[model samples]
Target: MKSGLTVRSDNYADVLDALNKLSGTDVLVGIPAGPPREDSPLSNAEIGYLQSTGATVEIDGEIVTLPPRPFLDMGIEDSRDKTTARLKLAAQAALEGNSGMAEQHLEAAGQIARD
Candidate 1:
């Protein structure tokens, strides 16, 4: 179990990295947390870096659900919200047989799990 504040700073990126390195496999990305904010905007380099490691990015954070399934680059309101959405999306993608995408989203979620 994770506390609300703890979840806020959940090292999602490290988690993804570990998961990738351990499994040596790719996964789909999802943003169950939502989308990235201005301060923490998703960058091509970041996305590319994750992709290079065999992962797909998705912005399924809980904040903005309008886009349904968005990419990490898409701008959103709060980092926490976006992070949550991405995490959820990543979980969904992984459960749906998209490990690459799941990993990507999980990475982003971990990134957002910061202070």
Candidate 2:
């Protein structure tokens, strides 16, 4: 039962490392949604939400009405083609068993998404 079967794992470490980084981890674009920072009155996400959905508030005893803009939605929709190419590259890298390269591609895609 001792057949000489040699297994090569030259890229195993890199692949594992890359998988750890890739699994359940992804880039998020746009303002983060959360409460305001300690020093700020509003988070960027709050501002964006208000702008996208519109709101009415009473300021100094006067009622002010805001209009819906949906800028974030428009931006995400517009960037569809921009990041698709990079994501495809990442997929190719993964298929070729080059995990490190795949991670790079994913990073590039994230950057494109952010941009």
Candidate 3:
């Protein structure tokens, strides 16, 4: 389907130019939670520039007003760590035969994982 920022070239400069052409539009930028890596498609600097253009940014389903550098990285790591810890707790609860507690912990884990 045709979506936002459609362009005709695969070059980085072309893609960026197309994005820049989107000025004055209410853009919704959705970024998944994850640590930045060398091979990431877009650098944190680029994301910050995009946000500076007044685009509404959503990280892991929550709307945020900050740039996408340290803030997004921290949020991603925090959410991942919480999800892992909750999953461990759920397993421990199950081992203790506390089915109710295990279920609750598992539900919490799911929510955090989604984030």
Candidate 4:
């Protein structure tokens, strides 16, 4: 006397798709590209990195020092709460198979990073 039960359900394809879309995305934060700095040849990104970490160089035969301003970190910290909330919503939407909402939330998080 043995009994077996079978459960039937549609595979959670939407959830899978959302998970794929949200994962492995590279988020960039900080200044966008622009014309080269008048005094420095470094690109905006390079300048940002130098400012974030601090650097020194000689210009016009005079030494200049860059302090660790950490603006990138500061901006992230400023948006930390809102970004995290969006990320959480994205995750929850993905788990619930709400792919569209998940993607929207993910995009909002990206916007937070950009701004």
Candidate 5:
């Protein structure tokens, strides 16, 4: 299937969670150009996760060099939590016989699950 995907990095946690679900795909992650802000700089673990995925990373249009190996022990518990919630919503939609909504919720849950 052919499709387009776009995700904003406004919520770093969500972005990280979504990244967990990707497999064998090239991704471009862009960071705004300017003085790094304390609140916006990516954490070591996040960077490690992206490095593990081999995604192309750019900061202010400049390509970033990634380390050869990902740092150890990056957990995705937040993704599991979000996936559980979405699964529940999907179940509720199914009970209401709203197949389309159920499908949407399940799709979201799948993304969170990285399935």
Candidate 6:
């Protein structure tokens, strides 16, 4: 797919010319997240500049630690639902080999079911 400013060339001089033209743009300048091959020197330089300016940098297949897992942000009991739904979830989890999660859901289901 043709990206915003993707420059492709077979010769080194042509590649350098493309990079020079793209240097003045607001686009992210750097080798994409993969093998640091291809016409990527300009991209590497851009990554360095971005890092120096406090921008988070991610390289090939690097898992950036985002804020947190979404589940960890919410309390378990906040998932208020009917007993049947909880039991179904528990059963599904059990069938899927998630015994711990199943037990948790089953416990919640049992509490609601008993009431």
Q: Considering every candidate listed, which one attains the maximal lDDT?
A: 4
Worst 10 residues of 2 by lDDT: 15-24
Residue-wise lDDT of candidate 4 within 1-115, one digit each (tens)? Answer: 6568564765589778877776855555678878788877878878888889998978789999988898888888989999999999988998877878987888888799668
Report how far off residue 74 is in candidate 1 (Å): 22
Kindly list the per-residue Cα lDDT of model 3 for residues 36-96, writing each as its tens digit: 5577555665665565454566777899776434454455466877877986776666555
C-alpha displacement of 85 in model 1, angstroms? 0.3
Roughly what TM-score does model 6 have, to 2 decimal places?
0.28
lDDT of 1: 0.55
RMSD (CA, Å), each prediction: 19.2, 4.3, 23.6, 3.3, 16.5, 26.9
Quote the RMSD, in angstroms, for model 6. 26.9
Q: What tens digits encode model 5's per-residue C-alpha lDDT throughout 25-108?
A: 222222223543477587655655677766667888899876555322223344668877876776666555455666677677
User: For this target, which candidate reaches the highest TM-score against the unseen true structure?
Assistant: 4
| TM-score of every candidate relative to the true structure | 0.31, 0.66, 0.33, 0.75, 0.34, 0.28
Off by over 4 Å in 1: 1-78
Q: Which rank order by lDDT, best down to worst?
A: 4, 2, 3, 1, 5, 6
Candidate 1 on 19-91: residue-level lDDT in tens? 5543664333433344554665765555444544444344655442232233343433246687779867876
Q: How close is candidate 4 to the true structure, as a TM-score?
A: 0.75
Q: What is the C-alpha local distance difference test score of each model?
A: 0.55, 0.76, 0.57, 0.82, 0.55, 0.49
Output the lDDT of residue 84, model 1.
75
Model 2, span 1-115: residue lDDT tens? 9889887657677666655656656767778788787876778788788889999966678999999998877876788896888778776776556777887888887777767
Question: Candidate 3, residue 52: CA error in Å?
Answer: 23
Ranking by TM-score: 4, 2, 5, 3, 1, 6
lDDT of 2 at 14: 63
